[model samples]
Target: MNKELWEKAVAFHGHACPGLALGVRLCEFVQQELGVGVSPDEELVCIAETDSCPVDAVQAILGCTMGKGNLLCSRAGKTAYNFYDRGTGTSIRVVARRNTAELSREERRRQILESPLEDLFSTTEVKYPLPETARIFKTVTCAVCGEGVAEHMARLQDGGIVCPHCFRAYDR
Candidate 1:
């Protein structure tokens, strides 16, 4: 069995690994480890090792965290996909905090190719932005279905409104 592969299959705290990061059993473990005790029936997510240490400082250096989500397409034919840790196998979603968006998707990915994985997240953390906090210009209603405006459903693209569901694109 690949030790590296196994480590990829566990979950760990988003930032500053908890005292009990004994292999990620569930995404909720972050809460449980802190004595929050999660319900076993709750869905769990897999957390891939985000560290790129030389098989030594993987735990101590791993940074940056993201959860699974569908791909989003822009009117400009741009495709934006959310990053997630596939190892955990959980359905939990982690939001991306705008404050921590230090690099463009292309830049961050380019970084992943040039440097050790840990460096990619050196300044970033598991800080995911909750969808609830993400708001559109005037309302949270889907431009197409007029349903609950979700972060994934609504995105700001060059001063325009984009509804990911029906792919609604319009300028303000």
Candidate 2:
């Protein structure tokens, strides 16, 4: 990984750690495999399985961010990330291997950064199609909260449209 990229990841993530290093390595490997660089648009999409320190690295390095709707979190609580390059119609899933050996935080981070790509992560072709690009939906006021929400995300409850945050299910 480039030292400047490492510094950028560290700066974006607030501090350096093993998780962030793993993410950086993953991005580097994916870019090399797909022959792509930081995406200026939605060409590079990432579906991360965990909301961890590494996600910051992905956002910083690959230009995949939640604001752009290219970085989606699956909440699987696993150290896995799926990258899709819309330009090439290529997708890969990279899962970090668990490091069981006890080591200092700095040591673990160094190991992750220095280790060969094959030793640190398992990569496979993604079976699913690329996720759709972000769509702009009309905004409607939530019946309960009176806050504007995308129409597609509004839920119907008690015959009124409410935002997901204000929707409640009947116990029955």
Candidate 3:
């Protein structure tokens, strides 16, 4: 990983934690594996298994952002990521070593920042389709909450569009 890139990541993530360092290394490995660099647009997609400090690094270095509809989170609470090339359909999954969990947060961060690439993570190639629903959505106004909701996320309740939150409220 480039020192300059790590600096940039630290600047973006607002700290120099282990998760951020791991993400920086993951981005570097992914770029090398796919023979590509930071995406100019939606050329690459990152599916992170958890919402953690590393996610910010992936966003900064890989050019996959939630606003762009390219960064997806799995909410699995694991430090794993899947990088997919939209143009070639190639993807790779990277997971941090489980033993890292044994270390204190500060020690883990220190190790991640100082360790070699191979020592920090295990990676594998995978095949998975980018969902059609991932890219496009229609915006609608929820009648109950009056908040804007994606059409796919809105439900029809009492002959009016309602967001999941509002719908759940009605249910309760």
RMSD after CA superposition, every candidate: 14.4, 1.4, 2.5
Our tally of clashes for model 2 stands at: 0
Question: Who wins the TM-score comparison?
Answer: 2
Model 2, position 166: C-alpha lDDT score: 99
**Candidates' TM-scores?**
0.21, 0.93, 0.86
lDDT on C-alpha atoms for all candidate structures: 0.30, 0.88, 0.83
TM-score of predicted model 3?
0.86
lDDT (Cα, tens digit) per residue for candidate 3, span 1-172: 5899999899999988877988898888788778778887788888888999989998888888888888888888988888888899788888887662688878987787777877878886643457432457889999987899989889888899999998855434
**Residue-by-residue lDDT tens digits, candidate 2, 1-172:** 6788899999999988888898889888878877878978899999988999989988999999998989998889988888898887888888888889999999999998899988888887663567899988999999999999999999998889999899997779
Minimum summed lDDT over a 10-residue window in model 3 is located at 126-135
Clashing pairs in 2: none
How does model 3 fare in lDDT? 0.83
Model 2: residues with Cα > 4 Å off, grouped in runs: none
Q: Is candidate 1 or candidate 3 better by TM-score?
A: 3
Candidate with top lDDT is 2
